[model samples]
Target: MAAYLKARIDLGTLEAGNKLPPTAALMKQFDLSDNAVYRGIALLKAEGYVHSQQGKGVFVSDRRRLIAGANRIKGITSPGESIHHKLSARVEAPDWVAADLGEGECVNRVRTVNRGDFILQASQSWVHLDVAEVVPEVDEPQACDPTWQAIYEQRSGNPVGVASKTVDARITSAADREALGLDADFAVLVMRSVYVTGDKVIGVGEGVYAPGHPLAIA
Candidate 1:
């Protein structure tokens, strides 16, 4: 099945660009019927793990692309890697943002995250301005510092409990095209997340990622 093949792929047993076993061989090895084997192959193809040719066998897809996930609230960056970013403060909270953080009570920080020369994601984080006394960094640009959730927890004296996210795809705008090195036709992934500590919404973030960047949720 797809799970078996994925495990092999993840373990390096089935390398990228390597052709999968023929239909009969796969069916025999897995004790699967023709339909079951094809279904499993179809699932893998749809998941971007493999591709099939008309008469040829299926081959694994390349997995070198960077993956961004919904659970990564702190943003993506390697250990000791400085995240290149441009940070700005928004004076007026957008209507939807205000609804999440109380009307006229939210202070917003927009961060455009980049890796080297390529822009990876653009994130807008909102927190109540009242907490500025405890988390003064929220008003300043952060090159590399504690995460928003950490600051909120420090001020509120409550541990973050859960994070909820919604993911969608949309066509890139002119600004996104230039910042993310993408064409107008390409689509980007947008993930909106709300970090919560008990019943309190500690922070809200909207992150937009460029196309071809894989996303894994765990």
Candidate 2:
């Protein structure tokens, strides 16, 4: 099942913002176990190939398109060197993200990077305002570059800790396009990450990215 999806992604048959077929349809098409289908999506989400929302459907992520199907997984912590390119620290943070992160307290770090002039915009997100004091250095944690990585690692030290995430695909709202510096034709990749720390819900983080940017998953 993983190999099949990998083939599709590699062939550009499934680009960023391309919604996956509905669960039942997918299961029927592949004649897969409900568990297998769910597990495949879970792997894709962790690798940053897809993002999910509660009511919305799963969608491909910008990073998924950027790397041309790089097989990276998101939210896994490694003690070695970083796998992702360093995002420029100067990306402007948006104000409307407060609603996206939902209540409590949130941090939005946006940046437009250049590889000698090519521009790529990205957002590093974090939530769980309730744990603000508990983890003061949310803005810049050496162990965790992405907000989701920081929260997941701080809460669960295991690099293999499992997470259940959903992916959604939607036309880019005017505000989303403007914020990501994308055009009306572009779509936003929304991922809702639910962290489970030893069978207990520790926190939830959302990762949003525009097309053409590859998501860095360990």
Give the number of the best model, judged by TM-score: 1
TM-score of each: 0.57, 0.39
lDDT of 2 by residue, 98-130 (tens): 333344445443343333333343334443443
Off by over 4 Å in 2: 1-103, 108-121, 140-162, 198-202, 212-218
What TM-score number comes out for model 1? 0.57
What lDDT does candidate 2 reach at residue 85?
Answer: 31
RMSD of each: 12.3, 11.5
lDDT of 1: 0.66
Candidate 1: tens digits of C-alpha lDDT, residues 119-146: 6677677776755666777777663244
Number of the predicted model whose lDDT against the real structure is largest: 1
Q: How far in Å is the alpha carbon of 138 misplaced in model 1?
A: 0.6
